[model samples]
Target chain A: MKMAEKRPLDDTELDGLFAAARSTGPEPSGDLLARIMGDADAKTAAVTRVSRPEAGRDVVRARPGLLATLLGLIGGWPAAAGLMTATVAGLAIGLATPDTLDDLTGGVLTSVTGYELEDFMPSYGDLLEEG
Target chain B: MALDALTDVSDEALLIAFGNGDAGAARALTLRLTPRVLGFASRMLGGDRAEAEDVAQEAMLRLWKVAGEWRQGEAKVTTWLYRVVSNLCTDRLRKARGVGIDQIPEPEDDAASAETGLQDKARAAALQGALDELPERQRQAVILRHIEGMANPDIAVVMDIGVEAVESLTARGKRALAAKLAGRRVELGYEDG
Candidate 1:
C-alpha cells in the first residue's frame, strides 16, 4: 500500500509531521557535553597562558629601570644638560677674573707712571748681583 | 558584575570575548550552541548519535578557531553554525556512499509515555526513512525549514541559495515525504486525528 499521498499534505498536516520529527530527535549525551566543555576549557586556558606574558611585559615597562630612575632623579636629560653648562661657565669665570683684573690695573698704571710693573720692580739680574 | 554583564551579551560579542581570552564567554557560548549543533547534526546524519556528536564537536572546534576572525554583521552566529553543520553533514553523507535508513539506528529517548513514545518513534522513524530517499539538497532544505522551524531567509543562508530556491526545494521535499508516508498514516495513528 502507498504510505503517503500523491500530493503533499497541507500546512496543518505538515505541522503535525514536523512536531513528531522534532520530538524524536536525539539529545546530546552527558559524555558529549563533558568532552566539548573540556575542549573549551583547554582552549581558554591556553589563551590565558599566552596572554599572561604580555601583561607581564606591560608591568615591566611600567616600573622604571636603574638608568631611567637615575635620569628621573636628575630631572631628565634637559635639566642634566643645563646643569653641566652652568658648572662649566662658573669655572671659566672664576679662573679668568684675576687675570682680567691684573691686565686692567697694569694698563692703567703704565699710562699714569709711564712704566709697567716690570719697570718699577728689580730685574732677576740685579737680584743676582746683590746676592 | 562581569559575569552578569556577559550573560546579556550577544553571541557575536561573546565570540569576540572568547577570542580575547574570556573563559566565561567561552563557557557561555558552549552552553548556548553545542546542543543545537548536536541536534541538527543528529537529524542530518539520519540519527547516528555517535557520528552526530563527532560532527557537533568538530563544528564547534571550527567556531572556536575562527572566533578571532569572525566579522560581526557579516553573518549571525547561528547562521554560520547551521551552514557549518550542513557542510559537515554533506561531507559525511558523501563519504558514506548512499547509506540510507537501513544504516540508521533507532534513536534513544527516555522521557515519554510507553505507548505514545513508541508511536512517536515509529512515526519519526518512518519520516526519516522517507527523508533518506530524497536528494541531499532537498533533504537539507526540508530538515532546516520544517523540522528545524527556521525562516526561509535563514534556511537560504544555510543552504547558500536564494529564498525562492529554498522554498522550491522544501516544497518538493515535503511532497516526496508525504508520498512516502501516505501509506503509513493509518498505521502511524494520523488516521484517527
Candidate 2:
C-alpha cells in the first residue's frame, strides 16, 4: 500500500508554532540581568562623571574663592555692598567732616573725644609748615 | 521612583533616566528588556543559549554606552536594540561560519505538566530547527515578523530596508519555512492536510 504524501504546514499551523515559540521564549537568567545592570550602572557612572564636573577635581575649583568666601561670610553681595558704603562714609566723615554730619552729631563726637577733626587729621599744609 | 511605578513608563524614558544614573530605571530596564533581548538573540543564534546570552549582554552593554546619546522620539528603543542584536548576531554568525551547523546546540526543553505543553514545546523546537536552516536574512525576517510580532515597517527599520523589501523577504522566508517544515507536520503533532 502507498503512503499518504506529507504536506507543508498551513498558515494556521505555522502561526501556532510561532505562538508556541513566543510562549516558550527564553528568559534572561539572574546572572545575565546582574551583568547587564552592572554594565548600565558603570556606564551611567562614567557618563555622570563626564557631565557633572562637581563629581571630580572640578568640584574643588567650583568651591568659593577667597573673595567669594569673604563675601558669603558677610551675607553675600548686597551686604558687602552696604558694608562697603558704610566704611566709605565713615572714612569720608573722619577725613573731611561734613558740616551736616557735625550738626547731626551736635559736635558731640569732637567734644567727647576732646579733639577737632583737624586735630586728628591735620592738613597737608600743617605737615609742610612743620617740615 | 519604584520599579513598579516605572511599569507604565516608556522604554525611552527609562533609558534617559538610566543615562542620568537613576538606579531604579536601570533595574526596570533590565527586568523589562533583558528577556526580550535574550529571546531574540537565542533565536538568531540558533538556540545556542550561551552564545545568545553573550550576544544579549554585549548588545545591552552597547545600548547603555549609547544611552546618553540616544535622541528622544527619533527611534524606538526596541527597534534600535533589535538592529544592534541583528548586527551582533550577523558578525558572530559570519565568524562562526567555519564551524559546522551540527555543532549548534539544540533548544533547551522545559518542564511541562500537560501533554499540550509538550506538544507546544515540540512544535517550537521543530520550528526552531527549521529556522536554523534558513538563510540568515530570511531567518531574521521571519522571526521578527512572526515570533517577535513586529510590523513590517518596524522590521524594515530594524533591518534597514524598505517596507516592500521587508514584505518580500518575509514572504519568501515563510515559503522556505513551509517547505522545510513540510515533512515534520505529523511529528510536530500536526495532522497531515
Candidate 3:
C-alpha cells in the first residue's frame, strides 16, 4: 500500500523558520573582528600617509637675493649682458672721445662755440676760481 | 570622535570619516558591519564558519580600501557590502562545486536548554539545509529577502537583478524551500495549517 503524501510547509510555517534563522544568525568572533579592524587601521594609515604633506619637502624656497631680484627685473642674464655691453661702450666712447662720434655730431658744438669739447669742461684753475 | 559618539552617525558618514583618516570611524564601521557580513557569508557558504569569517574579513578589507572613494548617498554601505560578500561567496562556491548538501554543517547550538529554544535551533538548521539545495541566485535572493529582511529593491541591487526578477527568484526559491522542508515539518515542530 502507498504511504500518505506530506504537504509542503505553508508561508506561516516557512516564515517561522526564517524568523528562527534570523534570531540565530551567527555572531562574528573576536578574532574575526580584530582581523577586520587591523585591516581598517592599516588602510586608514595608508590613506593618511598619502594625504599628509611631507615635512621640509613642500616648503617655499628662500626668497631671491636683492641682486638676483634686480637681475630678474632686467630680464635675466641675456638682457643684463646687453645692458652691460651698452653701458661699457658708452663709457669707452666718452673716455676715448672717438673721432667717429665727433664726425657724427658734425663738430657742431666746436663750430658753434668756437671751442673744443674739452674746453667746455672746467679745469682745476677754473674750478678754484669758481670756488 | 569617540566610538560612542559615532553611534548615531550614519554608515555612509562613518565611511567618509574613515576615508578622511578617522580611526574612530574605522572602529565604528568595523563593529557595525562585520556581524552582518559574517552572517550573510555564513548562510551563503552553508554555515562554514571558518570560511564565512574569512569572507567577512576580506569583504571588510575591501570596504576599508574603498572607503576613500565611497560616494555618499549613492548606495547604502550595507548593500554594497552584501554585494561584495555575495561575489566572494560565489567564487568560493564555484571553486568548491560538488560538495553535497549533506556536507553543509549545522549551525552551532547556542546552549539553549529550553525546549522552544531547541526547536527554534532545529528549525533554523532545517531551513539552512533546505537553502543549501537551491540554485545560487535563488539562494541569495531568498536569504536577502526573508532571512536578512531586506526590501526587494535593495535585494535587487545586492543581487544585481531587477526588482521583478528578485520577486520571481524569491518566489521560486521559497517554493523550492517549502517543498524541500515539507518532509521535515513534523521533525522541526511545524503543525499543518
lDDT of 3 at B42: 95
Comparing only chain A of model 3 with the true chain A, what is the TM-score?
0.40
Candidate 1, CAPRI quality class derived from DockQ? acceptable
Model 3 TM-score? 0.74
Q: What is the model-wide C-alpha lDDT for candidate 1? A: 0.80
Q: Could you give candidate 2's per-residue lDDT for residues B99-170 as a string of tens digits?
A: 877899887775777988888888888889889889899899999999998999999999999999999989
Local accuracy of candidate 3 as per-residue lDDT tens digits, B152-180: 99999998889999999999999999999
- How far is A3's C-alpha from truth in model 2 (Å)? 5.6
Question: iRMS for all predictions?
Answer: 2.4, 1.1, 1.1
The TM-score leader among the candidates is 2
lDDT scores for all predictions?
Answer: 0.80, 0.89, 0.88
Residue pairs clashing, model 1: A2-B183, A3-B181, A3-B182, A3-B183, A4-B181, A4-B182, A4-B183
For model 2, residues A8-84, the per-residue Cα lDDT tens digits are 67798889999999988997888999999999888877877687665666777687889999988989999988999
RMSD (Å) per prediction:
12.2, 9.4, 13.1
